[model samples]
Target: MHLHCYRWTGRGADRARESERRPPHPAFPASPLPPMRTCDWLLKPRTRIDASPATVAEAVAWLTRRYRSAAESFLHPDGEARIGLDLRLHLAEEHLAGGVDVQWGIWLRGGDFITAAVICCSPNRHAPHPCPAAS
Candidate 1:
């Protein structure tokens, strides 16, 4: 199984800043800095809003709330954002024997609409292990 990250940067340049600064997520240790990489999606000049948990459903809500275009029409009513974890495929394999760790991010375009989604797997010291491309 493969994971895919998706973002919708509508009618503009990409606008995701790779921050060397960490925002205090428990998953990261105090000493180890977050790896730097281009965000899964970058929609420029669009408004961005911050949310808690940053779930897929939130992304869907964003798109539906702001845009009436065909692109924003497919948001699931459940608002479950797609979970494209590279490890989901190996869940029954060796990796599961020891358990695994994962990280995910959702960037919204126009503040309410999601423009990009990113999911990084283990050993992401360099960059996030990208999933399949989003439409």
Candidate 2:
């Protein structure tokens, strides 16, 4: 589970437990995440696999690999590609707090294909999650 640390990030429970020696994902939010009891959430993948790294640097690298392709897809040869922020963070091990829905993503613009993103949202106390639209 790509745990942000202690809690699940996208990695499964067993996986996180297996690597107890390693300090969780090492990127947990300082305060505390909103009370997100159930893992019953929705997932939107831009591509087949989702490799959301824990840090911004890693995410950059992940995007770097696709730069060439992105360049080719731009509507214009001189078109520039952009990287949109898609960070999902929660405070460390503490009682979850507010009900702010988090939908993180790594957007890409330009190239042969338009920019695409992967968004993941969890349910909160107020309303059902994976709820209405994750499109």
Candidate 3:
């Protein structure tokens, strides 16, 4: 149930400057502030589905239904299954105009669900590696 969170830098320098201008708290000395993020305060309740015995077809169906237009599935070199989704669409129909992109994904291995995540990144950046790296 661990969630990996990341900071999102907005469209341009303006957002960065806005964050820098905030006064430091009395207890801490003035320093550069972290960039603002779109999901800085996301508090939505989360539900975990145990897919231990679920067939590949069932898992695919569930992910497809949940993610709709955003879902993508792939097979790893080690035979694990992976599913991912671009979640920003939940907020707006169009891609942000030079804003961050938000995504979520899961990994299934040995009939058990392994890892899941929500990632936020700059629109111009790509994942550091391939979806399910080649051995």
**Which candidate number has the best TM-score?**
2
Q: Please provide, for model 2 over 1-135, each residue's C-alpha lDDT reduced to its tens digit, 9 standing for 90 to 100.
A: 121111222212222332232222232222122112222222212222345455434444444444444444344443242332222222211122233322322223321123222222344443343422333
Number of clashes in every candidate structure? 9, 9, 0
Query: TM-score for every candidate vs. truth?
Result: 0.21, 0.31, 0.19
Q: Candidate 1 vs candidate 2: which has greater TM-score?
A: 2
lDDT of 1 by residue, 1-135 (tens): 222233343322222222422323332222122223323121211122122224433433433333334334434422333432223233322332232222222333443333333332232233443322221
- Which ranges in model 3 have alpha carbons more than 4 Å from their true place? 1-41, 44-75, 78-97, 114-135
> By summed lDDT, which 10 consecutive residues of candidate 1 come out lowest?
40-49
Model 3 has an lDDT value of 0.28
Kindly give the stretch of ten consecutive residues in candidate 3 with the minimal lDDT sum: 41-50
List of clashing residue pairs for candidate 2: 1-11, 1-12, 2-11, 32-91, 33-91, 73-111, 73-112, 74-111, 86-105
Per-prediction CA RMSD (Å): 13.3, 15.6, 17.1
